[model samples]
Target: MTLQFSGWLPGGPTRPTTARRCELAGGEGAVVRYDERADSLDFAPDTGPHPHGLAVVTARDGHWCLTNLHAEDTYFVENMESGGEFVKVAPRRRDIPIPFELARLILPVPRGAGMVKVFGPEPHYLAPSALSGSAANWPRLDEDCMYFRVLVALCEPQLRGCPPGAVPTVAEVIERLGDGRPAYRISRAAVNHHIDYLAMHKLRVGEWAGAADGKRSYWKREAVVAMALRSGLVGEQHLRMLPSRRVTARQGPGPSRLPAPPPRSRR
Candidate 1:
C-alpha cells in the first residue's frame, strides 16, 4: 500500500537544500498547492469515495514527509543522520483516467511552481504568470508523459493477466467477444480462427463434443484454466484435472438411470 525510496544525499555531509512541499486534494479531481508552510498536511478523514491518495509536505521544522493517501498510517522520516533522501512526490489525481484530449491541452503550459485544479463541471487552468509579475520557470505540462505513465499503470494488470503461457480456448474467445452481447454465437470459422490465434501464442487447445448438437466441436475450458493458473485464482494442480466439486448447478439432472424400487413385493 505504501512505497519508500531512499538514497544517499548528493552533497557531502549536508542535507539536500532544494526541498519543497506540496499538498494535493482529490475530489472531482486533483488540486495542488505548493510552498505549504504547515507542519502537517490537513485532510478530511477518507470516509467518502473520493479520498486523497498522495501527499507531499515539508515541515517548517526542516523535516520532509511523503504520505501514501491510500494508507492510513503516518510514514516517518528515519535514518536522517546517514544523509538519507526521500522520494520526490508528484501531484497526481486518480479515478479520472487521463484522456488523450486532456493530455493535449496540458502539454503546452510553461513549467514552474504553480497550482492546478482539475475538477468541477468544467476544468479551470490558472497560472501565476497570468496573475502578476510571476517568473515563468513553470513546470512543463508534459501531459503525454504523464498520460502514458498513468495509462500503463492502469492497464498493466490486464496485460499481465494475458501471459504468453496463458491462452484462451475457442469457446472462451467467443465468450469474450460476446461479453456485452445477450448470447454467444459459435461458428466453424470463428472457432478455427480462435484456435489458430491460441496456437500462435503457444497456448494449448482442447475440444469436446456438443451435447445438443453432437456434430459441433465444443472447446474445453483452456482460457479459464490458464488464467486461473497464472493468476493463482486456482491451484496449479487443478489445471491437470477437472474439479471434483461444481461451483454452480446446471438446469438439467445428472446422467439418467432407473431408480431402484423398494421391496414392494413384501406388501
Candidate 2:
C-alpha cells in the first residue's frame, strides 16, 4: 500500500488541495515533516509557532501515524469520509495511530488552520466466490428481502448522485419506506432491528456489543453504509425496491399520494 501527502512545501507555491505521493527509491517510507517556518506560514505568518511548530507523519501497514512536537497545543485528525468523526492528539504525543482511510490533519495557527491531507491505500476485501471460490469468507445477502429495502433507503442520497455525507436517520428511513403507503409503515423498533440485522448478522462490521448504546447506533449505521457501498453490496439499481417519488391520485382517492410503481414498470 502507498501513501500520499499534500499541503505546504519549501521553495514552492503552496497548493492545499492538490495531492502528491511519496516516491522514494528505497522501500523505506518517506518521513514528511511540517514545521512552523514553512507549513504554518501558509496560514499565519506573524504568530511565533504558538500552536504548531513541527509534526512528523509516516505510513505503516496501510494506516498512517503522526507525532505532535509542540509544547501545549493539541492537534485534530478528522476522518473526511465519516460525518465529522475526529480524534485529538495532545501536545508532545508520539506516534498517534490514525485509523482513517482519508484524513485531514488540522493544526491551529494564529488566525487560521494549517491542514495536511493524507490519502491512504483503499481498503481491500476478499473477492467474492465467483472470482476466487471464497464464498465462505464473504457475507451472503438476499437482495430481494425487505432488509435490503431498508439499506437502499439508507443509501438513497448517495445513489442519487448527492455529495457523500450522513446516512438517513431511522425516522427518515421509515418515512422513505412509507412514502404514503400504509402497508410499509414501519415502527422505530422494527427499523432499528433491520439495521442491526444487517450490521451484526450479515456484515459483521465490528464489536458493537460493548459500545455505549448512544454511540453504537450512530457508528453502526455509518459502518454498514460505508461497508455496503465499498463492497458493492448495494448500488443505484436497487433503488427500485423503495417507494416511488412520484405522487399520483389513488384509483378512487380524493388526495394525492406517493406509492410504489407497478412491479412491471418499476424501472
Candidate 3:
C-alpha cells in the first residue's frame, strides 16, 4: 500500500505539503503511529500479551513492514513497493524474547540509509541508549540472574572450607546474598517455589555438604554451588559475577584465588 506522509510546518506552503511517501509491502499495511518522544510504534494499548504488533524501518529505497506469527519464530518481510511478502528469519533464538529483541536490532541499524521494523508481544518504548543498563541488555542471558549469582557467590568460600554450611533456609540465602550489596528483592516464597521446580525435575545441584534432616526442597547450604559446578553455569572465572556485598568483608574485594604452587627448581 502507498503510505503518504503529509506535514505542515512553520512558514510552509499553503497547500497540503506531501512529504515523501513510502510503499508498505508486507503482511498487511498496519495503521501504525510512531511516538517520537516515546520512541515507540504501537498498534494497541498495553492491554496484555497479544499477537498484533508492528515495527517500521525507513530507507532511501523505501519502507518495509515486518510481521510475525506467534506460532513460531518465522517473520514475514514485506516489500512495500512490490507488495511482495517473503519469510526471512533465523530460528527464533531462545536467548531473545521476540518483543524485547526489537530494541537490539533497531539501534544498530544505520540511519538515513535503511530501516527495518519488528513487532510482537507487548510494546517496548526504548531509546537508542537502552543498552546502557543491565536489565535492558540482560547481562545474564538464559540463567536466572537472581539465584544463580547467589549460588556462584558461595563457590570460592565453600571450596576453601570457609564457614561451611552457612545459609540453610531461603531466608538465610536471601540474607547472605544481600548482606551489604545491592540485592534482587527476592522473597522466601519465590526461592521455595524455584527450589520445588528444580526438585520436581530431579535436577542435581551438585552434592550438598549440609545435613538434610527434614527440608522438603533440595536447596541446602551448598545447593547453589552444586548446581553451578554440575551445570557449568558459574565457574571460577565467573567469581567476578558475584556482588561485592555478598563477599564477606574479611575476604577483601572478593574471594582469594588459591595460591599457585612453587615452580620446580630443575625448571
The lDDT per prediction is 0.29, 0.66, 0.39
Off by over 4 Å in 1: 1-171, 179-258
Candidate order by decreasing lDDT: 2, 3, 1
TM-score against native, each model: 0.19, 0.44, 0.28
Off by over 4 Å in 3: 1-141, 154-156, 159-168, 181-184, 202-224, 230-232, 246-267
Order the numbered candidates by TM-score, best leading: 2, 3, 1
Q: What is the lDDT of residue 211 in candidate 3?
A: 41
- Per-residue lDDT tens digits for candidate 3, residues 1-267, read 343333322243343332333443433343333334433333332233334433333211222323232344443332221111123543322122222212112111111111233332233356987656545421232345554554554454543333334434566666655654455555777666555444333344333434445563444535544544445455555556654553335644766699989988993
Supply the TM-score for candidate 3. 0.28
For model 2, residues 1-267, the per-residue Cα lDDT tens digits are 334444432334444544444432212334433443443322212122324345656556656677776778898886666533568999989878788877777765453555566676555566676475445665777988888888888987776644457689999999999996779699999989988898888987765434435665577777778778766677767888888897767686466577967778555
lDDT of 1 at 176: 42
RMSD of 3: 20.6
In terms of TM-score, which candidate is stronger, 2 or 3?
2
Query: What is the lDDT, from 0 to 100, of the residue 24 in candidate 3?
Result: 37
